[model samples]
Target chain A: MPVRLFLALLAMFVTGEAAGQVRAIEVLGPRPFGYFIGDVIRLQVDVVLDEPFTLQAGSLPRPRPVTYWLDLKTVAVDDRGINGGLHRYRLALDYQIFYAPLEPRELAIPGFSVTATDGAHRVEANVPAWSFLMSPLREIMPRGTGDPVYLRNDTGPMILPVRRWLSLAIASGIASVLLLGLLAYNRAWWPFSTRRKRPFVQAVRAARRAFRSGSGAEAYRAGLLCLHRAFDATAGRAVLADDLSSFLKTAPAFRPLEPEIGRFFQASRRAFFGADARGAEADLPRTVLIDLGARLAEAERGLS
Target chain B: MVDLSSLFHHSGNRWAGVPLLSVERLKSILLVNTLVVAFAAFTVSGWLAFSAWNDNRVISGLATGRDIAVGDRARPEILLARGQFLMRRGRLDEAQALVPAVRISGDRRVLAAIQYDLANARLRTALRLIEDMKIDQAIPLINLAKDGYRAALSVRPDLWDARYNLDVAMRLVRDFPEIQPSSEEPPQETPEKLWTDLPGLPKGLP
Candidate 1:
């Protein structure tokens, strides 16, 4: 293809030199058939000049999006060594066509002008325009007229499964929190500050600890005082051993522990008022106090 | 996209003036919501599974049913239908990817149809193009379709449709010649000697 172009240029150059000028431009590719949108075409421009003239390097075309749907992608100028005193300039131009035509049609690749200088002797020459075939993307033939190939139908998105999962997760989280909260409320934990262990329950815990530590007489005395305080608090009055029957009537919760209550009072009398007070061995030993407190605590459960 | 902290902390405290957001009622409300949401999830998953089954039904139906042209592919059956269309159009990679996804109410017929369509699509197209394309290019599609039809028939021997298509495909494609195995090679006897080797026939009948 280049040899044919060179021969064609040679003929043009002979005529051009005889006319005191030489400029030949040829678009080499983009065959005349099956041309689609987004196809790039290549063109070559050869210029030969008579003596005292040189092709201007700075005058070549700059690449740009040239038209509505066409772009000049690249531009290159090569120096094909001078032959027979005719300066030769080869401009390789690349153009991309993005035109979509329903029917096959011709689209021109606009031409540009180049400059030649001979030390203050300058002349501008123009390359004539060229054209190539342009065709549409879709096939031109029809399959059937009754059920025409319609444009792409609209597609509806299915409900994403993640939304269902997310909702379920949220609900599960809330339910978990609710279950924990209910448990806390019922079990007398935090945020249910009003719910507290009864004083007798506290007394039971203290006595049980005293028994475990084997803190003999002092621990036993401490357990008695706490039991008295719990009895007084439950009866809403100071409860003495003499007022035991009245305390039981007022706080019937202690009725089930009446025997243990009487025992605790008798032991308290022996441990505190009797001469055996401050003895190394307590009449109401820590073990007995622990059992008495435990019975009272069991009765306390029925009260509430 | 749902901010759970905000749902817990936000002004969704009351519904219809019942103070539903208060801690007092929040527990019950949240518990109920949890149950409802779990039910919703189950329902949604079930609904989606049902649609998938329906999608398979439509896909298998597209093999021989109407309104299944290339352009009408944006339906519930689009997932498999698109693959089938692409396969018919000779786009194999995309079609193969959709083969494992067919399920019509967990029916095997749908699976058979899926396989049948995948193979028969190319077979039918190749037959159409036989007049236009060289024999070398058309034979591969014929063989592929033949194999697919055979596979479907193997699973459901009663599938007359698959049987018919198999017959058509067999005419276009031939299986490799079956060679019988033998311990010893046959005797390399000449045509004249074969008569002498025969026990019942006279050696010089002529």
Candidate 2:
């Protein structure tokens, strides 16, 4: 019974060894010397396993303080899939060493083991420890006159550069003002209102003023004279009753007002030459004359 | 002459028929549209300029170390400046409260700087406490400062000042593994053995 048990145990060990095995473990790192306190050291470990064995990710190291003076800042694993009938994985570990040594001294990063499994069998891949030299930030005996514990100055808040935004605002503001000016010019708003040659508009204003001050024949005669003056100014010459058609032909925009303009000329002739202001007012009332003047002004704006 | 007669005919037809939108009517429409656009542009640009000027003024005041009351919707730069101002005045809690707002700014550089400054302030206070022999009170503050420094380093790995300060804090208090109830074996090296094995203690002042 004892001989049979020994043979069974040997068979079990042989099968276990054959099922899973770590093929290779290789570590790549930076130059291991001349590091200062608080410097991060990174290591790349590549592990190759047997064909059926795969890395168990849970066995990887967690980010934590590995020692009092060293912190495992980060850990990452890259699966290389399968190549050459072997399962491969690359492990990246970042460690921040906080040791402030008085002189250049060597320190060792502790080794750890990761597990690989193939269903029923398990194997361990050992990553060897790494060592590096760390140097002190300052001298043991300082030459400074002040305190020996030298701390770095705080990085102050930066003053945001406002020049770009300010310039943009200024440029847009100028564009807006210029656009306003253009709109004002187009609308004949005051400033531009007086600058534009709106003869009929001025005529309507003068005729209204005359009607406001006077009454009866005098007001009617005055309104007729203002309308005649506006027509002459618009035509750039004296415009008689006979010249109405030619004036309308030259300014086609005013062709829509042909009948009303003809009535105005007939009224003008009666008021000034015929010396019958009441009769002229009867032909075209003061309100009608003023309304015609306003419409002519609007038409004149369209011509320009 | 042909063009003029056709124009006259068109105008006559317009007056006699539907009285279609005249040239004057079209001009009036154009004028109204332009006026609306100009007015809108003027209002918007004026508002932008005014707000930019106001922000600059607030920033200048902050630079001079004045405690200006800022609204909740203040920009990230203003919040960062206020946090720094608070830190300088030893109002650490108020400074720390501004972290979420500053973080939301998405300006990584500013966030890292703020974290580093807050950590520095904490470490300085903790050192003062240690000098006064308040060991228990200083321990928590040092731990907080270490976390702040670590956070800053995570965002910006090249921040040497934060790294140095973190190292200083680390030497003040050592980290030991937490005991797990499931593990039957004791830790490989006890805290006492690890502390004594190397000159881990801070010599003189940190």
Compose the digit string of candidate 1's lDDT tens values, residues A241-265: 8999987886687787688678778
Residues A57-112, model 2: lDDT tens digits: 89999999887677898999999989877888899999987676767999999989
What residue pairs are clashing in model 2? Answer: none
Q: Which numbered prediction scores highest in lDDT against the true structure? A: 2
Chain A alone, model 1, TM-score? 0.43
Clash count for each candidate, listed in order shown: 1, 0
lDDT of 2 by residue, B37-143 (tens): 65666666667667766877887787688889876567777787888889988999998998888788787787888899998999888777765767667777877
Against the native complex, each candidate's DockQ, computed on alpha carbons, is 0.02, 0.16
Question: Could you report the Cα RMSD, in angstroms, for every candidate shown?
Answer: 23.5, 15.2
Which CAPRI category fits model 1?
A: incorrect
